[model samples]
Target: MQQEKESAEEINELWSLYGENRSMEIRNRLVEHYLPLVNIIAGRLAMSLPSHVDRDDLIISGYFGLMDAVDRYDIKRGNKFETYAGIRISGAMKDELRSRDWISVSLRQKIRRYESAVVELEGRLGRSATDEELAERLEMSIEQVHHLERQINAATVIPLGEYMKSEAAIAVDTDPHRSAEYIETRETLAKALDELTEKEKLVVSLYYYDELTMKEISLIMHLSEARICQLHTKAMFKLRGFLANIDGI
Candidate 1:
């Protein structure tokens, strides 16, 4: 605890120094102090990405984010620098991935069709549709549906920074008036989560909330990694549809 307090004090001193002079020396020190944050976010993101995506490239992109955060951070905002910097770092990496357009146009179309089918079938059935039901509704074999679900899962394994922007996209204010919207969104998310099956819910919780790798989750759940991925994909689609219905997202 003492060590942590001392580290925080040092960082605050550096921040103060940089705020006063805006010198490269002080800024570089601040950057060095927070580089570990970039590594952590980059590492988590890399776990979800394909092996071909170079981890070093992600780290390099995230360095730019860290620099931007250092430049723009407001000490008076009452937000922790680490929290703000994590978002910026992860956002930078995601922007790099988006520029690459790793997921093909055809795959994107397939994902849209799959999401639409899921929404339609669930609405008509008045419940979460099973894999067989989804296959029947989409006029595809169960194997094909599973394959598409895997693809969707892979494509959707974006950093939490991007996930927050894409999924929430609402002002998170502390004032009662503005906060009401944020509260409602949280409630909607909770309700959508409740709609998921026990296994699907566990998968979502483990992957997102617990920050466990898919392999870790697979071992814990005693299921194949591929099966866990499918569950995550299904849960994400359901939550997206539910939120879309409520927020027109």
Candidate 2:
């Protein structure tokens, strides 16, 4: 407790100096103070990523986000700096992954086809489509379907902020700032989440809210990691599809 108090005092001092002078030296100190946050987020994201993705690269990408968060954070908001910085760092890493076309073009094409097949099959069946059903609809083997699901899981990394952004925006909007856009977006997200299965919801809750790694979640759920990945992918597709449909994007 004493050590934590000292660390907090150090952080407060750094923030005060940076806020007062806005000097590079103070800013650098602030960055150093929050650097562990970047590492934590990067490490967590790296755990679910493919082996080809370098964790060091994620940390490097996250550094920029830490700087940006330090520049933009408002102390009056009563929000923890660590919470704000973590979101920015994770978002930066995801943006870096997106810019690099982390998923191959061929794999992206397969993911698109799989998402479309799942949507169409679910619509026709009036239920969540099974892997066998999706395979039949797409005229692929069960193994192929599983492979595509795994690829989709590996390629897509949606941040929790993206999922909840609309609601957050709505919460912050004032009378003059309030708009139908935020409401619609929030509604769309709610509908999407409502459509998910209980198991999918549990996976999302454990992974995002509880901050558990995939291996940990798999152990708790008594399922294989691969199976958990597939469920996560399916849930993401449903949410993504709903947003796309509502926004016409």
lDDT of 1 at 225: 91
User: TM-score for every candidate vs. truth?
Assistant: 0.81, 0.87
Per-prediction CA RMSD (Å): 4.4, 3.4
lDDT of 2 by residue, 3-33 (tens): 2333787777777777788889878778877
Clashes of each: 0, 0
- Under the 3 Å rule for N, CA and C atoms, how many clashes does model 2 have? 0
Candidate with best TM-score: 2
Evaluated at residue 114, the lDDT of candidate 1 is 91
Candidate-wise lDDT, in order: 0.79, 0.78
Q: 60, model 2: CA deviation in Å? A: 1.2
> Following a full C-alpha superposition, what root-mean-square deviation does model 2 have from the true structure?
3.4
